[model samples]
Target: MAIAPQWEAALQAVQSPPAQRRPGRPRATGHPTDRYEAKRKAILDAAARLFTLRGYEATSVRDISREAGISQATLYHYTGSKPEILAAIHNLMADELLPRMNGILQSDLSPERKLAEYMRAEMELIERHPTYTAAMRHKRWLLPGAAQEMREKRDEADRILDAILQEGIDKGVFHPFNVKFARLAIMGMSNYIGTWFSPVGPSTIPEIADGFARILLQGLLSASPHR
Candidate 1:
């Protein structure tokens, strides 16, 4: 399946050879990766907040450092550069998201159930890390190197979704439609949760996921193409 047209330029840029990396401080602990991961998470979380608050282009390293409650040099100690930081935010999402996608794909559940679970998993991740999800959702402005590196990590979800959708379509479980558009539409609806959804508000993630899945399936299961 084709990616959305608007990302073509960004895709082309990513196909080229990527630049080399600037290594950060070596891992300090022998077993517990959490210390390093936690620090990285802190930097990434701070960057996510800044990235979403101010546009990625407008947000600066200094802003991220300040938001993260660290000196600029300390920030660099945890992260290499701005693009790397942005990439880390998305990578963090991908790291959490892909496994759930895989699990849903592999399950014996019906397409509708699989999809409902997918939404639950995605929104749960988003709810846990809303700014991070929002930053990744709205921004695609990474360097060629970072972008190239991230392509597979990010696209893995789409790949799984395509497989699921195609399988459902083949089995006549879901109505025939453009798989790419369907994927985009489903993801588009969920990604917006970062902006409007609130944990303390009326709807919970599971409820929202079920609601969204029901709404989408209503259209997917529609008998008439004219609708």
Candidate 2:
């Protein structure tokens, strides 16, 4: 049977072993700004991996330290607590994702194209950061105080999408629908990509992006009664 073009490569990447985990130490003073940023990114990456694989309640500071190759004290130095680490993980995701989403909002593309671009971008982002995806999967059920700020940031993200969808309606590019429901449906489709998408599989990122765009556009585009 022919494989679906949407998820093949993502599936493969998920199954493969991740690269070496990041260590827990701060960068040497001499390192470039980008290098310092890279190390911080690595720590967050490792924290996401551990927090996702093991529930927030079950995963300990030591586990994150071990996965990140740093001392627990060092982890504390970077981020005060495991809860704080979770916050940082979600913040990292928001930092990268929201701006790209904002860019899409401002583009003059057709509404359907914009929607498609958003979905495709969302998938690519999740695939690149599966650990964040995992944590997000359980976001509502997260331990108290662990995800509050992240949730706030995510709400802001949703507002951006809501505005775009509203624009599509105002412009007659989409059938009028409740903005909240529309936003949920769009996000549901893309956010779930992390649960299944793999980078090593047959489907390339562009392919998956294109496929998702088609599906979303088909649903959202204003239809012509005449075929």
Tens digit per residue, CA lDDT, model 2, 158-186: 98888888888888777777889878887
lDDT of 1: 0.75
- What C-alpha lDDT do the candidate models reach, one value each? 0.75, 0.70
> Please, what's the RMSD in Å of model 1?
10.4
Report the Cα lDDT for residue 147, model 2: 69
Cα lDDT for residue 154, candidate 2:
80
- Candidate 1 on 80-174: residue-level lDDT in tens? 79888887777777888888889999999888788889888888997776566657754468878778767877588888888887777776778
For model 1, give the 10-residue run with minimal summed lDDT: 10-19
After superposition, candidate 1 runs with Cα above 4 Å error = 1-32, 137-140, 222-227
